[model samples]
Target: MDEVLARQAFDTALDEHRPEFGTFFLARLLGLKISYPDETCVIEFPVRDFLFNPQGSLHGGVIATVMDISMGHLLRHAYGGAGATLEMKLQYLSALKTGSATCIAKFLRRGRSIAFLESRLNDANGNLSAVATSTWKCSPSADPTDGKRVP
Candidate 1:
């Protein structure tokens, strides 16, 4: 598929699946906007009390989750079907204290059965907060049970 169509399908699926964690949850709960700009997926989460850590900074797990989601979304967009993460590693570089943060994910490589991706999270001041890389196992487009594409 072309980039535009692929992005449309990916975003549509995201809305349908409503992935329960990370920016998906934050977007739904706080009305944050998620978009694909160029090769990267951008997510903006408004800093709120619910997302704060005990030390008054955003949780590292939260930053990791957003980056993971962004990576997964990019994989789906590029590969055109369901993909499950086989492994992931995240590195926290700095603390995310307040304001909004953005995640930029890029496709490193893709095969028929696997895809590798990397992403970085930056705070409002454009400082890098974390970086992550993930590998996903790409499943066939056809459903195993019904032999139809998953809708």
Candidate 2:
């Protein structure tokens, strides 16, 4: 994909469709920023009470969700339009406290139909909080004028 188009897509998604709940609750709650440079994708989220676990630490599920969203967002920016996750695996490495966190995801492979990505979440102090890998399947081509995918 062209670098300029990819960046434009990323910016558009953040401005228009980011802070997406259900899929990106933590990213919305924390005001995450997604960026792409070359093959790498980076997502940063601020820490807050809504994302805390019972013990007052950042929730593991929230961390995983951010990582997953980052991966999916990367694929969407790279491919254009939408893509669905086919599979994902998450590994939690450490506890995260209330602060800023950043998740970096990279494209491992990409095919016509599927894309593979790896993501890692880091706490404000730069400690590894979680790691995840995801596969996304692209949707079929959309009609040019209406911008809706044909069935």
Candidate 3:
């Protein structure tokens, strides 16, 4: 699809699904399906031409964005608020040629003002393709530390 149509579709979805869109409009554009269960956040999406590099592989930025979103999603679920990425490191083990893939994020630690999370991205065949670790500082708007003491 062209950029105009893509933007229009994104606008339509945003209008229909307001206030609870996961991550951002790009995820919606990229067709990311997000799920939460127990202590993990999972996102599955297809690798499309728009998200590919010149070499015909999934872009590194796309992988990083999914990883980052997974971590942020986990922090929001566990802490009741989204977070800002203070830092993150990613390792791209292999290239994804095509098809859908999955990203699973789990919390390493949830602190008063910061959270640590890790995400693993698996290819369409369910083989590990990339991994990332990130630290996020709880945003003021979503901070769970408003005079509430941690147990």
Candidate 4:
């Protein structure tokens, strides 16, 4: 592993993490660049060796986390509230060894209190790597602008 890059990633996460938008710790650690293009939430990130599994591929858990964040960010952006993931399922279609990957999350259905969302992760070459579908419980009382969890 590249110790310098790993340390930089850790330092960046510590220095830049916030509760709002795309500034979360995990996002920083993964060097994720998040954006809203049209109605979808997109996250592009580098594939670091530190995040690789024993077999030398990007770890499945890391992929799943990015997929989850994409959906959650979409919920927060579109609804002005945060969401609690009730359940999520993922399918890994391929392994990513190098280059960056982009995960795009979109809503399948949005309701008053519940939502269905899906995220697709593709390699930099535009090959599909994984897909995730999830159900979320919207916290209607949370305010998106303030980035505070309502409880």
Best by lDDT: 4
- Please report how far candidate 4 places residue 108 from its true position, in Å: 0.5
Find the 10 residues in a row with the least total lDDT in model 1: 142-151
Model 2: per-residue Cα lDDT over 5-39, one tens digit each: 44554564455553443234435444678788876
Q: TM-score for every candidate vs. truth?
A: 0.73, 0.73, 0.82, 0.91
What are the candidates' C-alpha RMSDs? 11.0, 11.0, 3.7, 5.2
Separate clash counts for every candidate: 0, 0, 0, 0
Native-to-model Cα distance after best TM-score fit, residue 32 in candidate 2, in Å: 1.0
lDDT of 2 at 6: 40
lDDT of 1 at 141: 76
In candidate 2, how many Å is residue 133 off? 0.8
Model 3 lDDT, residue 37, Cα: 85
Query: Model 4, 125: alpha-carbon shift in Å?
Result: 0.6
User: What value does the lDDT take at residue 14 in candidate 3?
Assistant: 76
For candidate 4, the per-residue lDDT at 108 reads 87
Instruction: State residue 150's C-alpha deviation in candidate 3, in Å.
Output: 10
lDDT of 3 at 54: 85
Alpha-carbon lDDT, every model: 0.69, 0.71, 0.82, 0.91
CA deviation > 4 Å runs, candidate 3: 1-19, 140-151
Q: Which ranges of candidate 2 are over 4 A from the true structure?
A: 1-27, 142-151
